[model samples]
Target: MSMQLNRKYITIVFTVAIIAFPIIIGFFMLNKVVDPEEIMITKTEVSPELITIQGGFGDSISKYHGYNISHHDHSLFIQIKGSKFPIRGDKDFNISFTNTYGDIAEIYLVGQDNAKRKIWPQP
Candidate 1:
């Protein structure tokens, strides 16, 4: 009888631990996934005249907004605000906008010139 009771106690403890472990892990994971702020923009237009960027993210320490332009495209416009560093062009020569919070967005442009043209016409 003593042996049976001990076995039952062990089984109960093990079952409770298994159930609690998963609940604890899931709680933390949900917090992490919900913590990151996200902003989405749809339908933006760019022309040679000016660049425009629009987005908002919560949290000052970890929030930013930017746009990405594709390689070798010159007809693209980019603008950003509230960023720690200046926007960088990608390897393909595309424009990229990033925020201070490490969020990045890109736009693809074509028929843009990245080449340096001569001021005077070639004779």
Candidate 2:
């Protein structure tokens, strides 16, 4: 009889742990993800007719005295020009220019990983 009672307690403990472990892990994961720092917005000026970007929507510089805003990411990357660079966390550098249409430019910075993107400044 005592063995049965002990078995019941063990089963109850196991059940509670099985249900609660994931909840606890999820809570910690959420906490870790919710603490991201704010993204920085920097602005610079570039000629609208300086460069032409050639992939994925075909962007280019179309405005004079336009803006070259970017969120520079220094993550591990290569510019496909025999160059490899590190794009660290919180160090992504994607640029977007301001023209008549909006924050889209013709000049693109193609990465070695086949990520073709406009070289405009971030907002």
Candidate 3:
């Protein structure tokens, strides 16, 4: 009876150890450092002026108001041209992207300052 009991105890312990091993290793892997070059873009857009914009190009992001002065409705527009579109200090300003890569180029934006931005897309 004693030998059988010992055998059962050893079997149960080994089974538990086998089940727990991967779980423990997975927990440790959570601390592994993530690569900085990899960015998860939530939104995507295509424009001719953004052909050179690739993954990890955008440094930050800002929102711009639309046609209404009071409505404050805006869209996410990361400026790849190194210029601020919103503060052009005009009400009838139309943002234009022309004379570059066709209007079908995919690009990504990166948000650095508490903003949700995207990357230009992987080359």
| lDDT of model 2, residue 100 | 36
Q: lDDT tens digits, residues 20-57, model 2? A: 99777654432221111112223334453332222111
- The number of clashing residue pairs in each candidate reads 10, 29, 5
TM-score of 1: 0.29
Best by lDDT: 3
Over the stretch 15-72, how does candidate 1's per-residue lDDT look in tens digits? 9999999777754432221111232332343444433343343433322432333332
- Superposed Cα deviation of residue 91, candidate 2 (Å): 18
lDDT of each: 0.35, 0.34, 0.36
What shift in Å separates residue 80 of candidate 2 from its native position after superposition?
Answer: 31
**Pairs of colliding residues, candidate 1:** 64-99, 67-97, 68-106, 68-107, 69-94, 69-95, 70-94, 71-92, 71-94, 74-112
- 1 or 3: which has the higher lDDT? 3
Instruction: List the RMSD of every prediction in angstroms.
Output: 15.7, 15.4, 16.8
- Reference-based lDDT, residue 73, model 2: 38
Please, what are the lDDT tens digits per residue for candidate 3 over residues 55-86?
Answer: 22123332223211111122233432222232
Q: Order the numbered candidates by lDDT, best leading.
A: 3, 1, 2
Q: After superposition, how far is residue 87 of candidate 3 from its true place, in Å?
A: 45
